[model samples]
Target: MRFVRESGLYPDVPVPEVYAWNTTFENPARAPYVLMEFIKGKAFNLVVRDDDPGLLSGLCAVPESQQVALVKAMARLKASLSKPVPFTEIGSLVVDSSGTFSVGPLMAIYGVSLGSPYKSIEDFWRASHEQRLLEKIPNFCARTEESFQPSERFTPHDLMDRYQKLSALIPYFKIPEPYTPLVLHHPDLALRNIFFDEESLLSDDPKVACVIDWSGAQILPLMLASCIRIFRGHRYTGIVVIK
Candidate 1:
C-alpha cells in the first residue's frame, strides 16, 4: 500500500490506511487482521444492475456510458499497478524489523508452506509444478482408510503420469521478454472489491474511490498479473480490450 501510494501512479484510487495489523495468530485477535480506515462508498457490483429490479444485480443492466467509465477507472488502476518496483526476488512484500520493506519468502498459498524467495521466474514455476506433482497429487490420490471410490474418470496412476510429463516441460516453457519483470497484483480486482461514490455513475467520469481487500496480493510476472478474470465471460458492446 505504501509503495503504490508513493509511486503516485493512480492518485485517485485510495488504498485503505492501515492503522494497525497482526500477520500472525499470536495476537489476541487469534487470526491475521488489519485495522484499516473504514471507507464509505457503494460497491461497484451493486451500483450496476439490470432493469428487472430483482434480487440479483450486475453489469448486465448498466448503461454503455457507465460501463465505459467504470472500465476506464479499472484500467487506470491496473495500469498504475503494473509499474515495476525494485524487487530482485520473487515473493510477498514484507516489512523488516528496522521498518524497511523487501520481498520475503512467498506466502503458503503460492509456495510450499512459506517457500523461500525465488531468484528467477523459471525457478518459481518449476518448484510450483514439482509441488503439485510430488505433494498435492499424492495427497489427492491417497486412499482413505474408510471404503472409498475414485470419482475421477482417470485413475490415480494416470493422473500421476500426466503430471510427470507436464513437469518435464516446465524447463522448456520460456517467458516472454516484456513479461519478465515482476509487479504487484491484487489477487482479486472484481467489481465487488471496488468502491465508489453513487454519484459517479451519473456522470461521464466514473472514479473509483477505494480499492479494498489487499489480502494475498502478490509480486507476479507481468503476463500473469495483467489478467482480470471478471471480464473474461463478459459480453457487451464496445468492450475495451486491455493490453
Candidate 2:
C-alpha cells in the first residue's frame, strides 16, 4: 500500500487517502491485508437512473485523450514494480507483472471461489482447498462454456484442452501485465469502487475518480476485455487501447 501510494505515476494526482494501513502482523496464522480509508463511492450497479441514468453517458463523454492518460498511469504502475514477485507473498504491491491475475483473490473475497489457485496464473486451482472446480482444462472449458451462449468461435472443451490458443489472447485485450509478466489492472476499478467529493467532483471532467476494489486484477486479456465491456462506459476514460 505504501509503495504504490508513494511511488505511483499519480503520486500527485490527488487520489483517495490511503493513510491507514496495517501490513505487519506478529502472528503468521492471520491472513495479511492492508486497510486504507474506505473510499466513499457509488457502484455502477442497480442500473443508471434518469438523473445520472447509466454509466454509458459518462462512458461516451470521455475523450480519446483521457483514455491514453489512464493507460499511461497503469503502465507507470506496472513499470514501478520489481520483477519475479513470488506467488505466495503477493500483497497489493504487485511486484510480479505476470502473476497479476484476478480470479483467486476475487473469488475468495466475494464468496464465489472460482476454481482454485493452480500453477498457471490464468488457471486457478484450489488455493488451499481439496475440492476444485476442474480436475483438468477440458473440464474447466466445459464448465465455462455453460455460462455463455453456445458459439462456434470456441467451445468450453477447447478452452480447457488448448493452452497456446488462450495464451495468445493477451495482446488482443491490451491488458497490462504486472505482478507476473501479464498485465497491471485495477481489478476492482468500477464505478462502485470509486470515491469522490460529490457529483460536482466531476465538473472539470467527470470520470472514475479513484479506482478501488483490487480483487480481479492481473493480465488475463479475455477477462480484461470482458470487464471493459461490462464496466467501462461513456464516463470511463482511462482504458488503454492495444493499437
Candidate 3:
C-alpha cells in the first residue's frame, strides 16, 4: 500500500492505513492478523466485467467512456510499478536491526519451511526444474505400471534411463541473468482485489479507491514480476507494447 501511494498511481484516493500487526499467537490454532483502516468501496469486478466479455455486455452497464477510463487507470498503475529499483542480490528483501534493507534468502519471505532460497537465478531455475522432474517421474512410473498388466510392464533399468535423460537436459536450459533489476509488482492484481467507490461507476472518470491483498507483493525479476492478470492476453518483455 505504501508503494502504491508513494508511486502516486491513484491521486485523491485514500489508501488503507495500517495501525498495527501481530504475527505471534499463543494458541497454535489462532492465526495472526493485521489491524488496519476499514475501506468503504465495492470490488472492481462487481462493477466491471473485463474478464468475461459476454457477462460484461449485460452485467457491466457502465458507459463506454467509463470502460476506457478504467483501462487507462489500470495501465497507469502498471506503468508506475514498472519503474526499476536497484538490488545487489537476487533474492527477497529483508530489514535488519540497523534499520537498513538488504536482499535476503527467498525462503525468509516465503516461509522457511517451504524451500531454501537461491543465491542466483540460474541456481533457482535449475533447482526448480530438477524438483519438477523428481516429482513427475515417480508419478509417471506409477501410472504407467497401473495402466498395464505385468506382461506389458517395463524393466527397472528402462525407468532409470528415462529419469537420467530428463536430468541431463537441465544443464542445457536457458536461465536469465541473476543481476536483473527488480521491480515492484503485485503478483495478484485481479479486478476482484481492486476497490472503487460504488458511485464512481456512474462517473466518466472512475478512480480506484484502493488495491487490497498485498500479501504476494514483491520486488523481483522483470519477467517474474509482471502482473499475470493484466498480461493474460499478451507477453511482457520489459518493454511496453500498446496494442
**Best-matching candidate per lDDT:** 1
Model 2 CA lDDT for position 180: 38
**Stretches of candidate 2 exceeding 4 Å from the true structure:** 12-14, 19-35, 38-183, 197-204, 207-209, 215-243
Where does candidate 3 have its weakest 10-residue lDDT segment? 234-243
What lDDT, from 0 to 1, does candidate 3 have? 0.58
lDDT of 1: 0.71
Residue 232 lDDT (model 3)? 40
lDDT per residue, candidate 1, 84-112, as tens digits?
77888787777766667787877753334
Q: Which candidate achieves the best TM-score against the true structure?
A: 1
TM per model? Answer: 0.78, 0.37, 0.62
Clashing pairs in 1: 50-61
lDDT of 2: 0.41
Cα lDDT of model 2 by residue, 47-163, tens digit: 254666544344334445544543443333333332332243222223344434232432333535444334443343223222332344444444544576655566655544454
Error of 1 at 161 (Å): 3.4
